[model samples]
Target: MDAAVSLLRRAEAAIPSGRGASALFAMLRPDDDPQSWRSTLNNDGAPYQIAVTDAGADASVRLIVDPFRLGRDEADRVGRNLAAFDRIAHRCSSAAAARCRRFMAALAPSFEEGCERRSGDIWLAALPGAAGVGIYVTARGRAPQIQCTRLIAAAGLDHHRAAIAAIHAYGAVEAYSIQGSRCDDLAINIYWKPRGGTPLPPAINFEPPALSPGSPPTALARAPLGAMTLCSTFAVLGSGRGSKIDLCNHCLGLDLAASLEILGRFCDLSPAFVRGAGDMLAGEDAEIAFLGVRVRPSGDRAYLYLKPAASACQSVPHLVEGATCR
Candidate 1:
């Protein structure tokens, strides 16, 4: 235990000035419930209490680290780390982060409006030390920016309220949570200014689909570029020679009819490939074209392959070949 404390101190010292606040906070509450410690510390605006017990030796150590009079340099360092922690936390699947991201995205237009109206810069910081989140808004050349730290120690209600009021006055909205080991319930707070003040524009509604009664809430949507859809149908086109052509998977599913329909929509069929079967139909029946449509699945999650329609004919030439298909 002594060695662990020494190691933690060394680690803290190694962290860059602005990136060690979270580690320091964690060190302060070592062996404590993270959720509970965060809530109690923030709620009471008090120093964290560390309890150490040795059952066999009948010895224990209880210590409290005060929060009020930290040096300015130390506070600045802590604040910087707190900001970094918020960014890291957002990459996780935590409920608090999800709520924060959703609220931020939903209110982006309003945020832009507010920033323009007040000529201020709106900034977000994750307050892992405070066990919640914080938002800051500062006008150009303004000193001591208007800042709000939510999910802070409960004992600091006056400070919290003041911060909230300042944020609201700047036309900002925030959501945060506090859950410490002692408290199982999650505390969430959302704040905005009243009508007489500079009002935040209405929140853009983006209600997710509700789950059925028996199911848990659906997971938050993955980031936009994380998933893609591929076509399930496509046709190969080529003579019995190497006339290799590559088309996007999405383009392969278009049947002759669908191709014509798409051509009608876009007024261009140059982007589409003529299926090999279309050649046969073109030769046999000028009015009725039979486009070869190959069907397959391609994505990060699964291996799906459909034999090329041309594969059935030994004499068919290899036109388009996907590396994965080979």
Candidate 2:
């Protein structure tokens, strides 16, 4: 028998067959290829892949995971199972170790659910050692929705804290207006400066709003462009009046998009202020000005600057203290 297959059988023998235990081992069978076997008894459309190897001495086992197939919930279950096995395997005898090996063997199919649930992608690699396990996770699109305890335990408390800090530092900012019959809505317009003193486009042109206050914000909604109009009623009567200023709808969107993009990049590189940053604005009341904006890349590490619209101000600059926000 293949060493990996033999180990799986031995481990299966140790588990009692009652109270959902059968369901647990149902995904594992004697004929199942230890290298190819995956737990899909609870599959829900997502894709997942897993690989395990014996690291020898320093680390008892190394498990490589690609959770592209599994939905978020299934992926989470798989992670939980691995954690449980990590604890159980440590106490098993040589024969038991072999069986337990196949349990986590190449069972990455479980994370497929996570992929679908959050509409994101995830990749995880774990090495189980005598001291503790080492894990590396990379995800894109939506944030992982796993519990904090599991995250801290898997990635180490220090790393988890740092990740949280980074997110806090990259806050979000929103801008909108309610003019005519439109309620709080996303507005897009284009602005053009006179070239060589030639006539320029109209100073203000009202464009149809694209989004509303209750709607989810989009990338374009963050940074506006073009000739802009600020409904004075929206600015003066809105609850956030004192806190938020009005701006050319187009300019507001453009600046916000740029800031957010920069902040997102900063957070990805350093997860130090994941929780502290919030929304901010600059312009106010019918005047084409800086709207509220969120400070990001927290602490003294990063900053954003907006200069008064001048014939000379060609581009906005975002900076990381000494460095530019490019």
Candidate 3:
């Protein structure tokens, strides 16, 4: 308990503050209900109310920070949104990082709004293992950026370089990735979005013979000419051609067709591929890549080859040419 308090204090101290801005923290032990634990200094000293009151069995610990003071209606909405976060933390604890990200994108509308002064809240959860997940939304310029990353903590926050980068880069960079572990095949994906713009994608770098160490499951290779910023990243395991799904299409607010199309363009895949792979890539060892854009295995099975895109830029050189295709 003392340790958690220290972490929250550190987080609150590090974050910038404004006149009407505020923050909240929630913590839960295994099988225990969530409790309002700590908070940052409220600029207006407004009486704080319980915002999110729910937690899941899978989520052992969750820390959320709402940067803005909320109205009654807004607080209720934020509470509901945090429930979605709780569900995602449980689902992502064992599933691939991409799957977790898809769930988050699906609930983007539930997030707190970001105007000129304040941005959306931040939510982070740590599972029993060294693995965890985090999401942050930014209100910068005319666009808002949403970033999510899979966590692998060696000891403390010192090991989470990508997380620190995201915190410092909140208003600056669009997206980037960090090497999670040198020995294990763990990498963090970072995606960036321009407010209403489609979610920016992580850069996937696949090298021949041996894939790039710490390469994410589903990522778009960064182009030299057009520097694409990252928006969110999911943890993926394996090297074979895998499947993908876009949860944004299934969510509310945005047009379903438009969301699906936007997600398709993010990976340079087709709408059919995005729609087909929905909720299917949640399994382990799901090797996901765009057909012509990344890797194309020799097979007619949709599972064997991601939908091909003639206009898709071949991000990296394919080594085996589907010689290892399942």
The per-model lDDT (C-alpha) reads 0.26, 0.25, 0.29
Residue range with the least summed lDDT across 10 consecutive positions in model 1: 234-243
As a whole number from 0 to 100, the lDDT of residue 256 in candidate 3 is 26
Q: Predictions ranked by TM-score, top down?
A: 3, 2, 1
Off by over 4 Å in 1: 1-19, 22-86, 90-93, 108-115, 118-121, 127-132, 135-186, 190-326
The TM-scores, one per candidate, come to: 0.20, 0.20, 0.26
For model 1, how does the per-residue alpha-carbon lDDT over 83-139 read when each residue is reduced to its tens digit? 433544443337645444433333222333332332112233332223434332222
138 in model 2: Cα distance from truth in Å? 4.8
**Model 3 Cα lDDT, one tens digit per residue, 162-232:** 44344334423332322222213433443332223333222222211213345422323322212222233
| Model 2, position 299: C-alpha lDDT score | 19
- In model 3, the runs with Cα more than 4 Å from the true position are 1-77, 87-90, 93-136, 139-157, 160-171, 175-188, 192-227, 230-326
Candidate 2 lDDT by residue in tens digits, 1-326: 11112222322232211122122222221221223322221111111111111111110222222232232365455555454444434433444333333323232223554434332222222222222121222222223333223333332233224333222223111111111111122111111121233332232222222222343335444433332222211121122211111223224334544544433432231222211111112222011122222222231122222222222111211100122110
Candidate 2 regions exceeding 4 Å error are: 1-63, 66-80, 83-131, 136-138, 143-163, 171-326
